[model samples]
Target chain A: MPEGSMGISNIATCTAPVNIAVIKYWGKRNEELILPINSSLSVTLHQDQLKTTTTIATSRSFQEDRIWLNGKEEDINHPRLQSCLREIRRLARKRRSDGDPGLDSTGLSHKVHICSVNNFPTAAGLASSAAGFACLVHTLARVFGIEAELSAIARQGSGSACRSMYGGFVQWIMGHQDDGKDSLAQQVEPETHWPELRILVLVASAERKPIGSTSGMHTSVETSCLLKHRAEAVVPVRMDGMIEAVQRKDFPAFAELTMKDSNQFHATCLDTYPPIFYLNNVSHQIINLVHQYNNYYGETRVAYTFDAGPNAVIFTLQEHVSEFIQVVRHFFPPETNDGHDFMFPCVVLKAGPGPCVVDDPTQHLLGTDGWPKKTE
Target chain B: MPEGSMGISNIATCTAPVNIAVIKYWGKRNEELILPINSSLSVTLHQDQLKTTTTIATSRSFQEDRIWLNGKEEDINHPRLQSCLREIRRLARKRRSDGDPGLDSTGLSHKVHICSVNNFPTAAGLASSAAGFACLVHTLARVFGIEAELSAIARQGSGSACRSMYGGFVQWIMGHQDDGKDSLAQQVEPETHWPELRILVLVASAERKPIGSTSGMHTSVETSCLLKHRAEAVVPVRMDGMIEAVQRKDFPAFAELTMKDSNQFHATCLDTYPPIFYLNNVSHQIINLVHQYNNYYGETRVAYTFDAGPNAVIFTLQEHVSEFIQVVRHFFPPETNDGHDFMFPCVVLKAGPGPCVVDDPTQHLLGTDGWPKKTE
Candidate 1:
């Protein structure tokens, strides 16, 4: 009856795509459950361009759970992390108790070792939390042999993470129930919905330490009357329009709504008490350049959305990508081809699939020994 | 009578202090009439530190209406300029028609010549329009022998100019009148009411060409839902609290409201279509600095407000002025005392009287011949 008599060990590696929200998710009604105040829709960028690969291994012989984020050890007792693990374990136990034919009943009680790493450089300042958490939840679910809808479990890690659990266009429904069961992400459209849609991530030149999203949203919910109004009166209508625009493949309609929603999100940030400024001078200039560029063409060829940071996530059709990239360079010229300011890391991305199991053993971030593999 | 044959001319030079809004006035119900969407309150800074000295002359033999601003000739037919002039003339004609014995009916047909100049350097980038328009209306009224309230007339030139027409704490009431007669500035407290209150104008060294207030407000009104909510739901209660704060001389209450209203105004700007950015990076830093300083003291010792530009106008009590100045210098060190970024032009000011007619001939910006006096 020894724990390791059968040497029970299972490892799953999953890669998740980053989602850029057109209808932004800002505040949360239930902080612990990570339920949003309003439903939000986002475009899942292709994983070939930007993604987070998470490798999770569970072993009965392991003493305790441990987690490494980008090769750095983090507190395993973090509330959100604990919540995600607890929910997945509960799901696995339920599946086994229901007499499911395929279930790793022994691994359900096993300690897990998790390691997540992003494909893109951290200097880009693109928020990886969405993809990281989504990957974590997906990989954890796989290792635990639980196949049920896991967006709700990912929701416990981060509100936006729920949306990242789906591919292409996704919306996180702000569920009404107190238990947050119905508050799961739904796929508005599949990966093949819009092949021409492209996203440009304009990395900020200056490194600005902006306020973290969790505290920012907390303050916005508490002090900002505008945030309350937006959540109650504005977002519901915006969500419908966004869904329609995505379904119709209307770039201009989609672009305009995306930019407005992003601006409104920052507006609420500024409206918070003592006010939070996520957009720096560079972000402001980029915004003007986008409008000016659009005005010049008499069309919104490109749209930008910021996520609690200065880095701009631009949405444009594949046809306009080259021209808009030229314009961005012209306005914000990189000092040189290799300058930091113009890192010009334009990962031209299109709508892509969500978390997928990676069969390649070499792609795992965690070693067979259940620890982060050191990279030289 | 031959032109200049009888030099029957009356010249009055009046200086109007600059007023910084604690409760901002953004967006107008009527563009032509300068009717505001919401009420706003301001603190009129001392004329000695910052003012617009405007000299107006009404002469029977002058050639035509002319204006020279800051020694540079400007078009006399600007619509807002014409509005102020026409209103002043109508008031004078009514006074003369009523058969007032002291009324100079002779000057009724006279052409006016105006020469306006700001005491603060143009490099300061403070909006001279408010003080300039207030002074123009007041001085024109004095020269034309009409003593009725002039904030309504000043408002035509610039929306914020109306608040500058009064000393101490002034509020521009957003009256529900088609004619905008009731939307005039009212004095909540005299200059002597809050003597301990002080203002520090932290003029920006670098000039930023922001969207002009008229166009910015126009866009906010047309596009931003947040602006509408702010005008209707937020400002009325804020206006009352601001007035009470002023009347009771509650520095902390007044300071908190000032910062919040300023932030809300900027929030509306960001919520505008394409969004407008008034507070630059420097302004944002100043805001953080103020909040941090206040936090350090365990009391709200100082508060900062930014209008439609980068310059920060900080409100604090006289007792904390020296310490705050030191803190500002420590945080934003001036580069060798003459660097452009650290102009550090902190003009300490207090509430002062409204425009007053300067009887001294030496102070006149206009010559006896109704022409601009050269400033050699």
Candidate 2:
């Protein structure tokens, strides 16, 4: 575990929103530093479908700084956990004059305790880690009263995680060279910039993975040169187009690029040594059906993109929601077949304010200390 | 509704394949004749997923030759049905003194009873009409002993109906409209040319549509100018690329073009006025999941396409089917939920022959004559 030699007391918590990559981040330049090979841009999912709530508590009663996640006490000694904790401490600004001696004037020399609970399932490929790491870093900064830009701290955890620090449009700069220092995320635009732009996340199947992003990216980078091209060529172009699309409110351009980039990214994965199969028959059917409908009608009405799992996030204007729902309803009628379930309720979220702390922690997180033990 | 005189006394039954329009035939130059503005392409699905089985009977005991579909006597006077029958009879050959018509003679006149049953649901965007028309033509051809190319006769029913004439990769020729006699389908390559290719059909939902294809296409063409650009600019290039991909056995290229073509076609649909929505969250999620898995692994693993409705037809290399199946299994796990059916076992067909008449018709299609009444 990342340990604490000096004495400290009292704990504080923090929260962060989930993000969906628009200009996807494909390869890595520095795996250890979590530095990206190219810049990536993502839209922060309004803390509903994707969020991470983390709590940090420091007490004299604690013997060491232990970390727990989603009810299970995780070994903080794991290199990833250790690296995240250590990096946060290094950047955290000191609050008082030698108040505890636990954290030095440099802020790097300190001990902290972290307990996090993700609102959604991890390893389901819904950007849970992006939210988790962003939350952890955000909470740590709050605990130490440090303000060194949360993205800077988030960069140390995962490249994409840095983008989750801000709501709406966020871009992660893929920096140059081997030391992996200059890379960090910056806000391009906020969700409020275009409130009419709505997204519907369709959870296709909530299946867990044998390999998580940590190793998946590594395999992808080593075996797949297409991954290299996507990181080097496609993402850069997509990034520029995305920024412009967001700025101009060009739905067609936005829809076209998002769909193309996503298809290309997956194509590169297929170009990898041993192919990966992420999409099922249902996924292809949806894409085909959407394309057919769009062609049949003749324009860009609803645009869709997918992350690691089989779930889909659809981007549509407010006006077209009902028509979209009705067409889908006809094809996927609520017919009960031998023990299988299929339903899609067009979930609409009235764009809310950016991320804010809840009135109370217990009710918000559904348990005590934001780390309730799983009853099941 | 193409009727014969009261003296008909014999019956003939036949089956034909349905062809889905990849480029899609949404606009018609002549609505009365059901002539399309642009050519389309489709693979005739092996009969298991979709096909039309029809029986034609002529009886001296009967009055005017009548028609029955799914065991219910449908309106024989429906204009479209009458048009189809009249056109076929116009070219039908006459019987000799022996009461047998030779294949050499063109079938210019025949008044025969007609009955058809779609193996799958009609008006579900599975192109039941395409198969239905093709079967009607083929059965009449057999009954009249006409030897004209199947495509030539099918065209009289519906423009896209011609493409269902041959198995494997088929292309519809967009002949000059000075005379509408030449537009017909031709086999690009036989099914034997690409034996390694496999198509997986996901019956997402079996619900029928409110808008029939004829009306739907008419509305789309009249209102949506984007459909014009799609037929002219997008489809030509896609057709070229698709043909080349198929010739080279380049799975990735073929898959990419097929998917791209599908998307472009759908984009045009959305561009239509009063935008059409053919895909839902479930469909979108499936698309995302497929792309994610393909991207994660980094290879050209699978290619997917969808028709007018929500059903997805996935084309993949025979080798990677297991991996594809595994990924699909993980996402759409067979589990009970809210009494709504969601998942089913993915069916894989061993390489086999195309449609052949069932030894015992009662066991599969419900009736050897026309069809059984709708159970529900």
lDDT of 2 at A366: 24
DockQ, all candidates in order: 0.53, 0.04
Per-residue lDDT of model 2, residues A28-83, tens digit only: 77778878768888888776645677777554434566777887778878776677
RMSD of 1: 2.7
Candidate 1 lDDT, tens digit per residue, B140-216? Answer: 89888888989999999988889899998999998999999999999999999989998888876547546888899
Candidate 1, residue B321: how far the Cα is off, in Å: 1.3
Residue B53's lDDT within candidate 1 is: 90
lDDT of 1: 0.86
Chain A TM-scores, one per candidate?
0.94, 0.86
lDDT of 2 by residue, B1-376 (tens): 1234443333456777766555556677777755667777776666765678876644443446567776677888877667667665555533344356334332233345676777666765577777877877777766665556767667767667787777777888777665567777877777777888877765556676445566667777875554665566556776787778767878788777666566544444543443444544445556666677778879767766666666666778788888887887787776733232364434543222222343333433323333332451
Of candidate 1 chain B, the 10-residue stretch with the lowest lDDT total is B336-345
Q: In candidate 1, what are the lDDT values of residues A1-376, reduced to their tens digit?
A: 2245434388889999888889999898889888889999988888997899999988776789998877788999999999999999888888888999866587777899898888776534565788988999999988888889999999999888898999999999998999999999999999898998888888875364467788889999999999999999999999999999999999999999999999999999999998999887778878998999999999888899988878888989989889889888877677744223454636788899999999998987877677788871
Maximum-TM-score candidate: 1
The positional error of residue B286 in candidate 1, measured at the CA in angstroms, is 1.2
Best by lDDT: 1
Docking class of 2: incorrect
